[model samples]
Target: MLIASSRPLAAAFDLALVDLDGVAYRGPEPIDHAASSLMAARASGMQLLFVTNNASREPESVATQLSTLGIPAEPDEVMTAAQAAAAVLTRRLAPGARVLVVGGAGLLTAVRAAGFEVVGSAEDKPEAVVQGFAPELGWRELAEAAYAVQRGAWHVVSNLDLTLPNERGLAPGNGSLVAVVRAATGVTPVSAGKPEPTMFTLGAQRAGAHRPLVIGDRLDTDLAGARAAGYPGLHVFTGVSSARDAVLATPDERPSFLGADLRALLVAHRAPERSGDGWWVCGAAAARVVDGRLDLRPEGDRTTTLDLVRAACGAAWEAVDTGSALDPGSIPDLAVHEA
Candidate 1:
């Protein structure tokens, strides 16, 4: 039996179901300090699972992307809405049950991997119909899904996100597809993502976490998922969410901790200082302080800071490297300082 916490934000829960796209990365660029934040959480002995509502990509692919972005992750560390949908069908249907999949390869792969037989055509007459976001969705596919549902096949959908963000802008998401299927069949498919408990349960079980902290940038999915899973979450403003959104969010959709970016959060957690002009190491990043200047640098990135103390330290280090006497006035202002 799952127990609900009276003070959910403060309560130390056993697992975290973190979203990927809008939470950790936006397009191909990793959100600022995303790698460090995960490293910090892992260092604190928190189990982490990367959960996503995007059913377009498989878990292995998602893991590969995370690894390329300098984050240590494996295929098993990732969870997608398609996986949740597959679990639902696998638990409800008999092994080798025929399933009509109308989505991307991710959904199809998960369904087949779960021991379900995929039907190529409506004439195949599946026992279940699974729907997700498919850019190639045509009228024929919609009609086929509707027809399958009408024939008493169980219906399942990956997520209900009305729009998915991309570098171009918001585009039609799984929710739009769900609406089409619902209008045609008059059947609301079971949602398997975000604000749904099944994804969190599966994530926690796989991660084997006793206490976790959810982190994300979207209020609707990541924050909602954390609340539904009864875990505390940290919200970063570097993605889809804004400071205004955080202030106006409902209790369930609001995060327990808020930060401008992932780096700011790590700085606050590790080297919190009031008055100082020195360098402080936080995870793999080194924050330096020079004569009224500050600089921040991650392991592989150039060192720069906005804080005066960190800037001074960086300047002194540069002087030492060139075998020149440290002159505070001669040090140039760090170019990478940002609020």
Candidate 2:
């Protein structure tokens, strides 16, 4: 299911819309080889835009964090869901519209920067409500958003990610917080983040990119966003999604390229080929699915485990696409642990 690229990805794509937390860093710590790999891609003339669904932090703050992680970046090179949500509000509401701010400084700053007056409570008769994620958020913010939404105010949210990866583990994301308001108000807010394509489209437009690649760890957000934006997606196994997930990805969530990590950008990607005996082969790795069970083998020569993953995914995807049942248990364990 993967696409072939004779040239290295850094050379093939003019700009890379890269995900932040899971792809580059796990939290306060950096992922292995992420700094070096990204630096190499930049050296190869591929511009990088750090795109994040976490809308709590501003671009300058994010850039500072990346710099501390050894990935030098400019504020302009970062795109946040806050910005996309602001853009969404700007297009729908008139200038100087009163908006109830339900998140932190980032969401407040974006809404204000978009020329909307920020209000704290629904009593202000806010014209709309925009929400994002903030560690300090509590029932008060959710209640305010709910009241505004119930009063027929337009509702916009930065993202709908239920979970967020952090230094400790998975925590509630903006979507989980948004759920509280949705339940109370009976209104589903318009999402302006990943899996919707606005963030990726804005990144490519800002970069002036003719050929942009979306690279990230989560398939649902990053890869799905790419599909929605009509861009190629490269899935890396360094984060939440695993090899098994890739092998079982649905049509809307499948990625165009697979890699162990960001290092995949520096190398050529080989597309899996269908062999005569119905096995899918990539380099020396061959994979086949028989009776809903997956079978993997190393053929003539030694091959990287990632190639085997590609081949396996190809075989499994083809089988699933052709109306054949696939057992999730048949998917191999090819986990790449984060350091």
Query: How close is every model to the real structure, measured as TM-score?
Result: 0.72, 0.97
User: CA lDDT of 127 in candidate 1?
Assistant: 90
Put down candidate 2 lDDT per residue, 35-85, tens digits, no spaces. Answer: 999999999899999999989998999999999999999999999999999
Q: Estimate candidate 1's alpha-carbon lDDT, on a 0 to 1 scale.
A: 0.70
User: Stretches of candidate 1 above 4 Å error?
Assistant: 1-16, 264-339
- For each of the candidates, the C-alpha root-mean-square deviation to the true structure, in angstroms, is 13.1, 1.8
Name the Cα RMSD for model 1. 13.1
Give the whole-model CA lDDT for all candidates, comma-separated: 0.70, 0.91
Clashes of 2: 0
Best by TM-score: 2
